[model samples]
Target: MLSGIRIVEICGIGPGPFCAMHLADLGADVIAVEREAAAGAPSSLLNRGKRSIVADLKTPEGRELVLKLIEDADALIEGMRPGVMERLGLGPAECAARNPRLVYGRMTGWGQTGPLAQAAGHDNNYIATSGALYYNGTPAEPPQSAITLIGDIGGGALYLAVGLLAGILKARETGQGTVVDASIVDGSAHMMQLILASRQKGLVTGPRGENMHERSHFFATYRCADGHFITLGSLEPQFYALLLEKLGLRDDPRFAGKQWDRARWGEMQAHFTELFASRTRDEWSALLEGTDVCFGPVLSPPEAAAHPHMAARDIYFERDGLLQTRPAPRFDGQAVTPRPLPQRGEHTGAILAALDAQAASVWG
Candidate 1:
């Protein structure tokens, strides 16, 4: 969908490269800039489908080369603290001045103008500020960080890609460029909209694990006889009834009424704990897979890769002896082929050759 678009990615950890990968997957011409010292480093899955070039922005010539690439590009994505780009002489203002139609995207943990914009932080810190961390984990335990997936990939990379595409559409229409400030904190907070609504409606409870979905037996994970886990999400009455029937739980009066009542939650959970322990995870999966019982076995990474549904969907791909997920949403009736992750600065010569040709054409 993004054919003919040219994007320059200033390489960083986590989200920036991920956003660039998405663009490249959609057929955009993406060039990733890596530091000379970092050349020949290990390949990263997030940097797939991109040509890489080595440039030390600290040098005047290197900085000039990046500016030239910006002039010929449609967009630039960078993940850096507020003033870091400005200090390096490649901030949004500098880039946009070179190409008025450029969509300059900045990805940061905090917003560009916030008090914590210049502070050092990571995904855990960002999600903590957004109340997302509060709602994660079991009701009895302190909130566990859900890895970098939520704040970095979900918030930063996905939101930045959306913002960049929106900006690109507007720039195409107006012939004017803009800056996209995509903050992980803001995006994470935005992701909690449903929880906020539940709270406002007085349907949610305090103290973390007491909520209907978080603490309730009907919507949580349970251990089976083999010590493997299974998840349940039978929120509706019909599905709940189906789950009860599947587990032979109809005789229990404790789960009979007021599914959302906190007073009976403990009793319901205990009843479920006993029921789930009678069977293994595989047995439970067999009983629940085709029904509306909202059940699934808890799968580890390797197990997930080999899951029947995942295999049918072609979700995982092996390239260059490395396993990674394929680009999402099959396009044009064709699956996006997985490309091997690039070694740092792998395509420097080819990318610079193309840039040199463009420069020579302009001079002529």
Candidate 2:
């Protein structure tokens, strides 16, 4: 739906590229600016479909080139830490001075004006400070990181993409641009609102494994006979009944109408541990794959790419000899596949020539 929008991304390591990739897939024209060294690297799936430009942000000419690109862009995204852009002369104030309608997007681990804004950190540190990491693992262990998904991709990339798009809309309507401070810490904290509410209402509580969402027999993972694991989340009453019937436990006196008996959860889970182990992952999946029991097999990345569902929908594809995911959140059941990844500075001359041609035409 975002067909004609234009985005210029000052490429960084993680979230910035991901956010730009999402935009490009949604039909936006995305240009990626990279350092000279980075531009020379081998094909990365992250740089797919972007017109890659190699520029030295530290050099005056390079900085000026980026400034010129920003002049006509609907939005500009950057993931540098606090004061880094200002030092490079590409900060929000200067960019806004050039084009008042430009949406300036700033991405960071900590927010632009926080105590840790200037501190060096990563996704783990941001989620750690946001109280998000505390609820992940068993209480016996320190909080698990969830491997940067919760902070870097979910909190950082997704939020920046949403903020930039929203700001672009407002700018187009009122000709008044805005700055989006898309901080991973802030987004991670915001993400906890739902769980925080659940905790307040006593629906979700205790240390990690003691909560209903975690420890309950109907909402846990079980090991199969083959040593692989399968997960279950038969939360609703009908689904719970179905699971019990499928497990041949409906007639067992131990589970007769004991769904919410929290005191019996451990016993129930123990029973499940023994029972599910009787069958292999394939066996259990064959019995309850597409049912209302809310089940999915734990799959590695390659396995997931080869899954039947993935193959049917083309969720993953090959481009330039690299495996990459298709654009997500389709529009009217349609999403665009990104073009091939650009080589180092592949479109530098073309982009510069196009800009000069447009400039000359307007002036002449």
**The candidate that achieves the highest lDDT relative to the unseen native structure:** 2
Q: lDDT, candidate 2, residue 187?
A: 92
TM-scores for every predicted model = 0.95, 0.95
**Model 1, 1-364: lDDT tens per residue?**
7889999999899989999999898888898998786435786788888887889999998888899898878899998778888999998888888999999999999989967878999999999998888878786778888698899989889999999999999999999999999999989989999888989987675767768877788998899999999999998899988878777766667666667777888878888889889999999888898689888899887788898988888788777777788887687767788555677887878877887898889899
Candidate 2 Cα RMSD (Å): 1.7
Off by over 4 Å in 2: 38-40
lDDT of 2 by residue, 1-364 (tens): 7788889999888988889988887788889998787535774577787888888999999898998898889999999988999999999999999899999999899989967889999889999998888777654567779787999998999999999999998999999899999999889999999999999988787867678866789987889999988999998899999999988989888897998899998899899999999999989989988999888788777777898987788888775566778888977887567777888788889988988997898899
TM-score attained by model 2: 0.95
lDDT per model vs. reference:
0.86, 0.87
Model 1 TM-score is: 0.95
Model 2: lDDT of residue 197: 98
